[model samples]
Target chain A: MTQTIIWTVAILTVLGLLLALILFWVARRFRVEEDPRIDEVEKAMPGANCGGCGFAGCRAFADAAVKAPNLDNQYCPVGGDEVMQKVASILGLTVEKKAPQVAVVRCNGSCTARPRTNEYDGVRSCRVKAALYSGDTACSYGCVGCGDCVEACRFGALSMDPETGLPVVDEAKCTACGACAKACPKHIIELRNKGPRGMREFVSCVNRDKGPVARKACANACIGCGLCARTCQHGAITVTDNVSYIDFTKCKLCRECEAVCPSGAIHGVNFPKELDKEAVKKRIADRKAKAAAEAKKEVPNG
Target chain B: MGKLTFSMGGIHPHDSKFARERAIEQLPLPPVVYVSMAQHLGAPAKPVVAVGDRVKVGQVIAEPGGFISAFIHSPASGTVKSVAPRKDLAGNPVVHVEIAVEGDEWEPSIDRSKQLVTAIPDDKAAILDRIKACGIVGLGGATFPTHVKLSPPPGKVAECLIINGSECEPYLTSDYRIMLESPKEIVVGAAIMQKVLGGCRCVIGIEENKPEAIRSMRAAVAELGYPGIAVQTLKKRYPQGGEKQLIDAVMRRQVGSGGLPIDVGAVVQNVGTALAVYDAVQKNMPLITNVLTVTGDRIPGNLQHNYRFRIGVPLSFVVEQAGGIPDTAAKIVSGGPMMGKAVSNLDATTVKGTSAVLYLSEAATRRRPETACIRCGHCADSCPMGLEPFLLNRLYKAADLEALEKHAAQDCIECGCCLYSCPAGVPLLDNIRQAKGQVMGVIRARAAAAKAAAEAAKK
Candidate 1:
């Protein structure tokens, strides 16, 4: 038994030495000479491999950052300007700050204004729907109700209001990726300036199909009759190709476009001052009275 | 030869090619046509003709506004009634030249004969010029100008060219029909593309279901004795026709995240593109019309018709020719069921990118209720471009542009693969698209700023 134990020990020693020699050979022959800068830059990176920097992964981005002359436009959205500065410092380049912006769906063609016409029966895809034809609604310019915009959204910023068949974008969740814009063949779901405090006023409808056709399609389709431009006190609106476009930079969030739009094509978000419900009621009454007065005027002056 | 395939993230939807048996037929010309100017994927074309001007079929009405844009041509000889804005399929009122059709008179320069011509252009510049003059854009639903794709940007070398014959979308067999009927045209077109791309190695990729097409394509390649240009059979998968996917399958090169196929030393052309190239280089014919499948036979009342239509023909008119809407047809889509747009207006005219018009019965198109993301990464796993759709969806919900860019949400191809694969029917792509635009905007602004800084430094 004692002899057998010693023999076992000797065999074990030989096996251990063989394993050690194999390890040593592997370490020496197949060693990786990784540049320390790649590791350092990678450590500073967001490591999301989101390809926003046009690289496959964070490591690749780090390598690119090291090789590039500057981190000029290579700001990582996840990391923001602060993370970019660190990367720039490592690369001996300067980084600049950019304004944070989110995606804002301009239109508000909800179920209240935009109603369904025919039902769609195919692959429940926005792209397929958009590729096939206008959606299951009278408004060819509005959302297809198929959720292609929602499907296109990579940032979960947009959602379809099941009650409305229109997309509702969460301002805070939006990342301005433009995937939805490309996905939307109708191009109604636009990514506009988020602006300060999420208060923005822009022409929501993209339908430039003239007054009569636009009116027939959607109750709130933009007529593009230049009423919004005329109503804008700040010369910030432009009328071209039967479409009204508002310059958000120049126009303050006055919501005049919303008030003046005959079809309510212009939309607003987060108005601080509560809209006077009584005033709106009064205005509608006054407008009816004015219409009655105008009709009376149109009658022969007998 | 072994069957080849583009790797990863493709679905095999039902190939409901009910109209496959139908031979290509010419649709009766409508009394009126509204021709769109911006048919290609670039700047909107500028209208050169005015209202009240008489024009012939295939006559240029709008000129290219940019290098990437294509010129607009009249589909029929007619008197220009109104050069005004008309609602397109997407509800965008583009500049359309409204023509009151007179007759089927074509432009005098065009040879209307059905004789097959095999004259190849002598030089690369001549071929490119011919293609440009023809206004040949990708007939594969992309509408990218063929000349632009053939002519790579300066310093970028195109080592390989791929012919995309994979008609991966279900119910759309336009390319398949072309391959089966006119294999020679496709082959000649491919050879022309190879020549224009400076003799790059070319491969024709056809799906396995199309053995007849593959055999025909292979036969055409052999008889032609075109060295390096070969045919490859791909696994049938939805979106296999996608340029990136096709390139990957053929070259085994992942076009890199946020990079084009051209970046990987490959230029992928669609089967329709090859036909257009052949027409441009060999026949000197411009791209004013294409083949489209108007299918719905499986549908109770839908017509299954294969049509060769001119650009700007109204969907209403096309549907009317296909025995009108199936009395049971609920929705009229402009393309295949998988990626097609549901058009509300039949008045909207066909553009260059139109492939098929599907009138799905109510049973085929009722969208399922959208539910919460059950953390099923089907969207991510099925994404052709390798995007984390769930993560993007979350960032989009938060309006976290920084997180979106950090996650590389901008790389999404918007192919609806994520949305299609979701078991819970989550609209992952819809929300992501908005964020994508915003991120792209930020990127563009940064680029502009960098450019401005660089110019300032130079000064």
Candidate 2:
């Protein structure tokens, strides 16, 4: 029995050494040469591999960045500016600092604002509901309230408010990856700049119905009266398709447009104080009066 | 042969045909009729008339917008109230031509006489032109232009024409009433279609539950002495009237995925569509009316009706005329319970293919709480297209597009068979439908890319 045990050990040891030698030879012969910077770049990444950078994963992004001439198109939305700075430093490339943005639920058609026209008892999916019909409310371009954004959110930044039957965004948790915006079948969620001190003004409604129809459908629907557009001194707002849109780049945050909005569709959030609507309204009226008087003088000269 | 049925998975929902024996009654004209330009399956028709214009019944109001679209004729003689966008039954905005009724004056070109013109015209092109001119579309709950179906594309010869008198969807008896009332016209319509298809043999397939329809159709065929037209009794099964299923039931041919019914040398037309064709060809009357069944378990016996309703009457008006919605009604479906659209707006007017107004009670229609899939194979068993809905649902959750393609998600017919038979009450059809749409989009994109590549290679 002792002789047999010795023979078995010697045979196994010999077999292992022969296999190791073969493996070493194969590895050396067929080795693929890859850039060493790829590993460094990947290490600098957050490694969530969420494809938020428009690649397969963090490794893919790293490989592309290493091979790329410059990092102009590669932006990791989830990693934001700081991580991007690290990546840029490692890659010896420059990346423009993009403004941090958050998803804004453009629809304010709460249960009370937009009463249910019919009961939708189909699949509890916003995509399915949108495909099936114009949703439970009369406003076809409002939030479906099926929480598809919540399901698509990778960071748990969205939840459905039961009382309002609308999605609420957790500003702190949102990475602004735009997944929620993409998931919204109604295209109601928009990625806008978080703005200075998180104080920004935007239209809270997306309804494009005509004035009477829009008002009848939802109390908060944007009637597209062009009052807000006329009130903005910086030409930041434009009305198209019966809806008003505020261009964030040109917006001055003067809160004049918000005060002139008759339907209360324009929303200014995270302000230090509640807006004094009467004073803003008076200011707008005075400005309009001055503009009208100047226009009258120009008309006489022409 | 023994009650013929498709040799595949199908369900047996209780055929709640409460109004099967109800005679067809004429519905009185509403004060105003809102005729939608999107009554058919393709692009919305372009309106030709303006507001305040006088329109006679059967006068063309809208012209076909695309090759697959049908013409729209005014249903009532009236003054045009508006030519604007209006909400349809599903609450989607569709362009409608609203007409305030003046009188029942018809276009002089239409023959309003009731005399049956039995002579089959030999000119195929003329027949097709007349059918198109009269705006006859299939009334099988899919308002496909009938003229398009009668004319198969080149190199595809129709071997058999199946007249779908099956009326297989539960709670729907509109086709049955029409078959009982206008059996001769339906036979003539089938013969006309058969002649259009180079004199192909025709088979009228009706379910055994509709024996009276079968008998009347058979008698009509005999009396007309139409060569090569016969009526076959089908097994009572849900969705047996589906085009592919009917072809399989009658011709024993399986339509390949993403293929048309003509690929199998079989062309199917609903019984109501055949009557419409008969009216269009013989009487030169445009399709402006159809028989619709108002039925439900909760609806009182006297209130249930099989009414020959003019297109563009509001559904709410019809319901009001029939003693209003029942208190026990929880949902109003615009077709069969299996695959009907829930009525979101009763104010929306009826279109050509509006088959029934089914009011299902809460106990009968509400979804039960979902449980974990026990893998009983019931969904697979009931899927008439032979798809595994449970597998599709799981893959959809994972968003695995490749696996979904391999499972042929695009072939799903969305008949709700899987959801109807699932023991777990899982929303199988819902997920599968979404998956199917996504996969189909991918497939279309791939096809377009390949076409572009081929063209580039040629360059």
Candidate 3:
């Protein structure tokens, strides 16, 4: 028994050593000389694999970054400027700081604003619903409200608001990954630069029907009356396809377009709401006081 | 003898033919008709008449816009009220010409005589032109322009003219009623199509369950003595009336994937389309009216009817004529239950392809909760195209377009057989249909890119 055990041990040890040597030689022969910076850059990434940088994954972006001469156009959107700064430091390169973006639904056709003309009873998927027909409302180009974007969101940044029957985007959690924009069948969601103090102005309507027809469909539908375009001194607003679009790059955010919009379709987000309420109340009180003074003077004259 | 069916996969659903015994009735002229610009597969027609213009029945109100589109004629003599966007049966807004009916005078060119004109013109071009001018389409729910189908692409020869009398979709009896009531007209239409195809052998394929239609068609063929024309009985199965399945059943020919029926030397037309062709070729009539069945199992027997209705009549009017929608109805379909789309808006008017208005009760239309797939292969077994629907569903959920293309998701006919046969109650066809659309778009884009590259290289 001792002889058998000794033979087995000796044979196994010899085989293991031989295989280990072969593996070591093979590894050396097939070694692909990759830049050591790739690992460091990948480690700096958020590892979200969100494809927000137009690459398949974090590793792919890191590979491209390490190989490229300069990091002019490449940046990790999920990790934002901090992670990108870390990556740039490791690569000893500079990246242009890009303004952070968040997805905003361009449609404001709430259930009350755009009444449902029909009821859909098919698959409750926005893609399927949009492919079959327009939304339940008369406006053919509006949010379908089927929660496809909610389903597409990986970060749980979207939810269907029961009161409005429209998708509500949670700006805090939104990475501007553009998954919702890609998932929306109507192309109603867009990635806009998150402005200073998260205050921004945009047209909340996408209806492209002629003025009267669009107004007939939705109360808040933009009629492309050119009022907003004319009001913008910065030439930021342009009407195309009977819908007004505001170019964020040129917008001064003066809120002139919002005041001049006839349909009230232009909306400003993250602004103080109490100021408008106070201004309206002050105007009403001034009118009432003026009327009372005029009545007293007329009674004395009679 | 072995049962006759398509070679691969099929399912046997409950017929639910509640209106089988109902006789065809004629619906009165609607007060106002909303004629859609898009009644066929290709580009929508362009309006030829403006608002306030007077039009007679069968007058061309909208002209065909492309090579594969059909003309849209006025269904009733009326004055055009407006040409604007209106809701279609699926609630999609389509350009429609709303006309207010004043009278029922038809165009003078149409032959209104009761006599049957059996003599077919040998001049194929004239026949095709007349068919095009008459706006006759398939009327089998596809509404493919008949003229385009009759003329196959160059280098392809039509071997068999198959008349589809298989109304396999449950609760639809319009085709059956047409076969039983006007068999002679249908046969003559088949002969005319055969002549157009240069004397191709014609076979009328009817389901065995529709024995009355089979007997009538066979008797009509025998009495008429139309050479090279015969009637064949098909086993009852869902989607048997599909062009590919009918071709396979009648001539044992399989249409290749992404290929037309002409590729397999076959030209398939519906029985309703055959009658329309007869009207267009022999009687000089444009397609203005279509027969449709309004049926619900919950409805009283006397209320169920197969109505010969003019195109552009609101579905609400038809439902009212059929004694109103029952309270038990939870869903209303524009066609049969299996493949028909749910009617979302009653104001949306009927088009040329409207065959049956089916109402499903709450119990019948209730969807069961989806469970995990046990890999029973039922979806594959029931797919007429022999496609793996469950696998396609998975790939669709994964958003893997490359794998979807490889699995031939574009070949799905959207027959709903997989959904019907799924024991797990999985919505296989619903997901596959969406995937198919996406895959088709990708394939078209790729083809366009290749063509552009080839052109650039040549330049």
Candidate 4:
């Protein structure tokens, strides 16, 4: 028995050594010449693999970044500029600073504003609900309120307000990853610039119905009356398809259009003080009157 | 002599056909009617008439917009109030022609007499044209343009024409009522369709639960002595009225995945479509009226009705006429309980294929809380299309598109059999429907790409 054990140990050690040599040779033959900087770039990433960078994961982004000549096309919305800076420093490249953005729910059709016309009794999914029919409210172009966006959010940034029956985004936790925006079947959630001091003005309602029909459906529907467009000093506002849109790039945030909006669909968020509606209205009226007077004078001179 | 059923899976939901005995009654015309252009499948018809134009009943108001679309005729003598986008039953924006009813006058071209014209016209093209001009669609709820279905592509021969009288969905009796009331016309319609399909053998498949309909149809076929026409009894099964399911029950054939009924040498039409064909071909009457059943367990027996309603009448008006919405009603479905859409807008008017106004109580309609699947295999067993709903559901949640397509997600008939049979109360049909759509989209895109590549290679 002792001779058998000694022989078994000796044979096993020899077999193990043979296998290790084969593995070493195979690894050398199949070795891929990868840039070591890829590992560094991946280490610099937030490692969330949220796909907010439009890549499969942090590893894929690192692979692409190391291969790319420059980081012009790649961006990580979740990591923002700081992580990008780390990645750029590791790669010895520079990236243009992109303005930080946040998702904004474009619908303001709260439960009280838009009364439920019918009960939705289907799978608790916004995609399923939207595919089945319009929402419980008559305003078809509003939030489905099924918490699909909340489910999609990886950062715990979105939550449904039971009182309003609408999703509220917690700006502090939001990373503008755009997963929630993509999950919204109604296309009511949009990513916009988180402006200087986190202040921004945007048209909160996406309703394209006519004035009377929109007003009848939801109290806060944007009824393309063009009052906001006419009131804007900057040529930022335009009405298309019976819906008013404000160009963020051109908007000066004077808040004149917000005061002139009849349906209160234009929202100004993170402002230091509440808007003085009457005063702003008076200022817009005065400005319109002055413009009309100047146009009359020019006509007389011509 | 055994009762006929499909070879695969099916479920027997309680047939809550409360209004089966109700005779068809003509509903009074509403003062204003909103006729939707999207009454049939395919592209919505384009309106030919403008606001303020006077139209007579049976006059063409909207012309077919695409090859697969149907014409839209005025259901009443009225002045067009407006032609604008309006909300449909699902609250989706569809173009509508609003008209204010003035009188009961009809187009002089239409025959006002109730006489049944038995002579089968020899000209197949003329018969097809008449059917198209009259806007006759499959009233079994799919509303596919009948003209499109009758015209089979080259190299494909129709060996069997199945008239669906199964009325397999619970709480729907419009087809049953028509079979009992106008069996002769339905048989004639079948004969006409058979003639159009190159003298194919015609079989009318009715569920065993509908004994009266089956007996009446059989008697009508016998009296008419129409050659190559027979009435076949189908085993009572949910979704048996589906085009593929009915064809399977009658022809003993299975439609291949991603293939149409025509591919298997069979064509299916609803019994209701047959009646409409008789009207369109024999009387030159446009498909502007249809029989709809208003029923539910909560509805009073006397209040339940099978009304022959105009195409553009509002469901609310019909409900008001047949006793207002029941207090116990929790949900209103536009068709049968199994596959019908829940009605979201009552003010939205009825279209040509509107089958029923079902008022289900909360206890009867509410979905049970979903629990963990117990792996009982009931869903797969009951799937009439032979789909694995549990596996599909898991794959769908995982978003494994390639695996979904391999499992034939596109072949799902969306009959809700899996959902009905599942003890876990999982929303099997909902997820599978979405998966099917996604898979179909992928298949279509791949086909389009292949075609594009072939064209490029040729160039």
Best by DockQ: 4
RMSD of each: 12.2, 1.6, 5.4, 1.8
Ranked candidates, highest lDDT first: 4, 2, 3, 1
lDDT of 2 by residue, B1-459 (tens): 778998889999898899988999999999999999999988889999998899999999999999999999999998999988878877777889999999899999888887888898999999999999988898887889999998999999999999999888899999999999999999999999999999999999999998888899889999999899999999998789899999999999999988999999999999999999999998898999998999997678887899999999999988988778988899999988998889988989999999999899999899988989999999999888888999999999899999999999999988899999998899998898899999999999999999999999999
The deviation in Å at residue B172 for candidate 4 is: 1.7
Instruction: Please identify model 2 stretches exceeding 4 Å from their true place.
Output: A298-302
**Model 2 residue A186 distance off true place after TM-score fit, in angstroms:** 1.0
TM-score of every candidate relative to the true structure: 0.69, 0.97, 0.90, 0.97
Candidate 4 stretches with Cα past 4 Å from truth are A1-9, A85-94
Clashes of each: 82, 0, 0, 1
lDDT of 1 by residue, A258-287 (tens): 776778777777778865545654665586
lDDT of 3 by residue, A1-302 (tens): 99999999999999999999999999999999999999999999989888878899999999999989998878777888889889999999888888988999999889999999767665789998887777788788898889999998888999999998899999999998898999999999999999988889899988888888789889999998987897577999999978999999899877777876778898899976522634544555576689899999999899
Candidate 1 TM-score, C-alpha based: 0.69
| Residue-wise C-alpha lDDT for candidate 3, range B234-336, written one tens digit per residue | 8999899999999998888899999999999999999999999999999988999999998866767867899999999999999998888887788888998
Q: TM-score for candidate 2, please give it.
A: 0.97
Candidates sorted by DockQ, descending order? 4, 2, 3, 1
Model 1 regions more than 4 Å off: A1-209, A218-302, B300-302
Predict model 1's lDDT versus the native.
0.78
Number of the candidate with higher lDDT, 3 or 4: 4
Output the number of the TM-score-best candidate.
2
